[model samples]
Target: MRSLIRILTTVKELRWYYWGIIICSLLTAGTALLTPFIIKEATDEVVASLQGRGGGLSVVIWLAVALLLADLANTIISNVGGYLGDVMAARLRTRLSQLYFHKLLTLPQRYYDTALTGTVISRLNRSITETTQFLQSASNNFFPMLLTLVASLAITAWYSPWISLMLLVVFPTYMWLTTLTSKKWQKLEGEKNTHVDIAGGRFAEVIGQIRVVKSFVQEKRELASFSRHFDATVGLTRTQSRYWHSMDAARRGAMNLIFFGIHALIFVRTIQGVFTVGVMVLLIQLVNLAKQPATMMSYLVDTAQRAIAGSKDYFEVMAEAQEREGLADPVVGARKQLAPGQPMIEFREATFGYEDGDNVVRGVSFDIAQGERVAFVGESGGGKTTLVSLLLGLYQLRSGQVRVAGHDITETPAELLRGSVGVVFQDASLFSGTVRENIAYANPDATDEQIERAAREANAHDFIMGFEHGYDTLIGERGLKLSGGQKQRIAVARAMLKDAPILVLDEATSALDSKSERLVQQGLDRLMQGRTSVIIAHRLSTIASVDRIVTLRDGKVDEIGTPEELAQTGGIYAELLALQSGSKRDRKKLKDFDITA
Candidate 1:
């Protein structure tokens, strides 16, 4: 209930919608109860007129007018109530989706690494959908049914006490079974949703990595894996349906039997001159009111329970602790921005590990003055990439200080810190967008001339123009339409267009052949000319002209100096160079980085 209340509280802005539903619901309930009395008065009026009593045709006209007014008002109010409910549901759904998506962006890097995109996507969508569904059922079905049920019983007791007394005897058993089935359905729904999401996850995983699946020739294996999830979902749904239908069959049968039993007793009393035609009419209408709620009870509970179960997953994500900007000073609403006199990049006694007291990067410190090109080279898992993560404010530091443009990284806003630097990763990730959109991704406001200049600097201008649409051509997903070299060049071109004060290139040329490598290297040269550049050198040749080469071994800085200077030291850099130039056996050792000459 608290969880349900928390979900409701998020839409405080739409309180008017909720209030409107309640007001209309009350009016509708009142009108429905009045229906029995209106019939009773009409029946009495007709009989009295037929028997030539004091009442005449005037009574029938007044009763007809009252019934018409009540029904018309009820119809208008119910329609308005339904409209408000839909509006509230839409607002809640949109709000929840925004919350989930925004949280996805704010969550730490580790969350993404461990989380499956398919599973998360399914949960996010289902949570919002289910939460709104639950709200609607509660408002439209559960609450209304309950209110109507109470009013119907009172009217039944007033018309015929014996029938109402019989209702009291049967109500408890009906409610007990309904409550019991509702709980079971909720549990089943929760389990079914989990399996359903797993099925969605499997579908996403197999399709997203279709290239890998095809290369591995694992079509049969993948299909079998997907089939397992599908079958489980089907089996659970079948069981749930069986239980539901069986319970419904029982509920309807019992309610109908009770209904007829009361009817027979009423008929007997009427034949014995104990009740008039008007009284009989009122009893039938009142019985039907009771039966309506009784019949709908299971369905309403099923919808409500399913909704609550699904929304649980949604609200769980909403409650996640959000990461906020750390202030340099204890001042309210003071955001950290670029402060003057900070180094282009500085790491002081920096030590970091994914887990506590376990450092993957230990006590490493470095400085890259403005416009200096430095390269980081190391064996795999020696924390070459972790350093970039630290500088970018992607991870929280275990200890020490990382300052970027003079402001502490933790103190600076992540968006501003990243905006200050341009990056070209080896993967060459591009969206399913046009060439123009992809190039101007970082700076959407860049002029056409600036975009062309960046493309020319990247050696991508000529090839891009070769397409009939030029910059307007669709690149497809992750730029699949382009070759590896074309993709990397475009990625570099994108970085060039960003034109930040600092640049980081992680093995930017590792995947390119010699001809493509030379082209991309020239583009990189143009891009890195005046920026503070950091390169993670996978190939020894790529870092030959760097101002300094920082060697890392076992998570600490092994050595730092020029390539020529390190070549003479017989250290890790020298050892790497020797190994690369050695026999075929030594070549396999550095194959991960693919730095062959």
Candidate 2:
């Protein structure tokens, strides 16, 4: 019962389109049960009268027409019910997909990091497909079956109350058996879903690293691993199929036994003259009508249970906690929230982590004045990235505060903060779109002239125009068609177009050749002319241009000073610069390939 309520709740969220069909199906079931009476009348009045030489031909014709019309009514109602099922499935799919996409926009970054991509995709694809079909069937098919059961019982009572009561016993007994069988099937389905998810995740992982597998001669290994999961999926599915057929055959046999018993009973009663031939035929037809609903009842229980489980998963995603919002009565925009001419960013004893794991950034405090260019230099896993993430409102602080542009990031709306900051990472991600579209992504309202200007400033326009499609060519998935340097240049152009008050670069030029790096450095200098910039780089020469350097170790700031001042101190920053430059000789010995080539 609770499951039914949950399934209905999901259905109710969609606008009612097939609900009329449900009403029509019930009406048709009632109309169909009336068919037996017409058949009985035709048998007694039409055929019997012709042999007896008493009644007129008109009685026979009228009974024949009545039976014909009952059949026609059944056909029309069944067609309506089928049409409604299609419409309901269509609407349910659209609404559920929309809800899923909307929920994705609010999920925390940590959720995405920990959850497999294929698991999320399977839930939206396969799970939603099953759920929508089940919902449509429950409304259009299940309701009609229930109505048929009621109408069949009523008609049977009119013929023989004792026989009707005996027939009614089949309904509850089959229902109980169906419920038990369906419960077992639901467990198998859950197991089947788990294996299916594993298979999808494995496939996605293999495809993402196909080049690596081939390079390492591990294709056979990957195939063998994939085959193992595929076998598990098939094994579970075949087990489910066998169980389904066995239960189906058993239940069908039971129904047939009741059907034959009713027929034998009617035959004996007719022989004893307890009922007329027409009355016996009517009871037989009624018994057959009862079977239709009884069989459907079993299927309805199975579908209902599957849909119930699917609905629970659907709502679980919908009910995920959303990102927090600011107070209702609050400061308006970024400018209004921040004090006039104060520092653009400040971290006051802030601490944070991805989850319950060890804190990645702890007790970090710093302030960046307006228009100041600051650089963070630290070893890998030294919390440099975590601090930038917190400043961008990607993760909330556990204690203390991180203020951006004078407004607390945790208390401020993320949408507003995102607009005020432009960021470029080491990966330099680009969507599958034209050069112009990718550059203008941060500011969709950018004019063609503004796009060209930004591209020129980022030193990407010359190479972009070299292509046959110029700015119009598709970049393929994640800009795979372009060279690494070309992708990074486009990313730089994107940051330039946003023209935000703050710019962030996390090894943005590390992928470029020396010449290209020089060009990108010039562009970065121009983009950061007046904006406050925070950069993270391994090349000590590149970050040396920033006004101040901040060095971190083990989630704590160990030192901060001007580039020359830090270099003079022989502190952590000086040691890093020495270590990075010492590797320059080895780096130069490597081949110089232009990432844009």
* Candidate maximizing TM-score: 2
lDDT (tens digit, per residue) of candidate 2 on 1-597: 465455456668544555577678777887777787888877777556667853778887777788788888888887787787777778778877887887878776766777688777777776677777776776666767667777878877876787787787787667666766777788887887777777787778778777788999998887888788778878887887788778877777787787777778889988999988788888887787777777776566666666766666667777877676655323223444456678888989988877789888889998898789999877678888888888887877898898777677777777777778889898988998888899999989999999999999988999999999999989987899998778888998999998888889888887778887888888788888888899987576777678998888788987889999999788777665555456766444222211111
Q: Write the per-residue lDDT of candidate 1 for residues 501-553, one digit (tens) a residue.
A: 88999889888888998899999999999888999866788898999988888
Q: Tell me which residue pairs clash in candidate 2.
A: none
- Each model's lDDT comes to 0.81, 0.77
Q: Which regions in candidate 2 have their CA more than 4 angstroms from the true location?
A: 1-4, 11-15, 53-55, 238-250, 326-337, 580-597
Model number with the top lDDT: 1
- What is the alpha-carbon lDDT for the whole of candidate 2? 0.77
RMSD of each: 3.6, 3.7
Estimated TM-score for each candidate:
0.89, 0.90
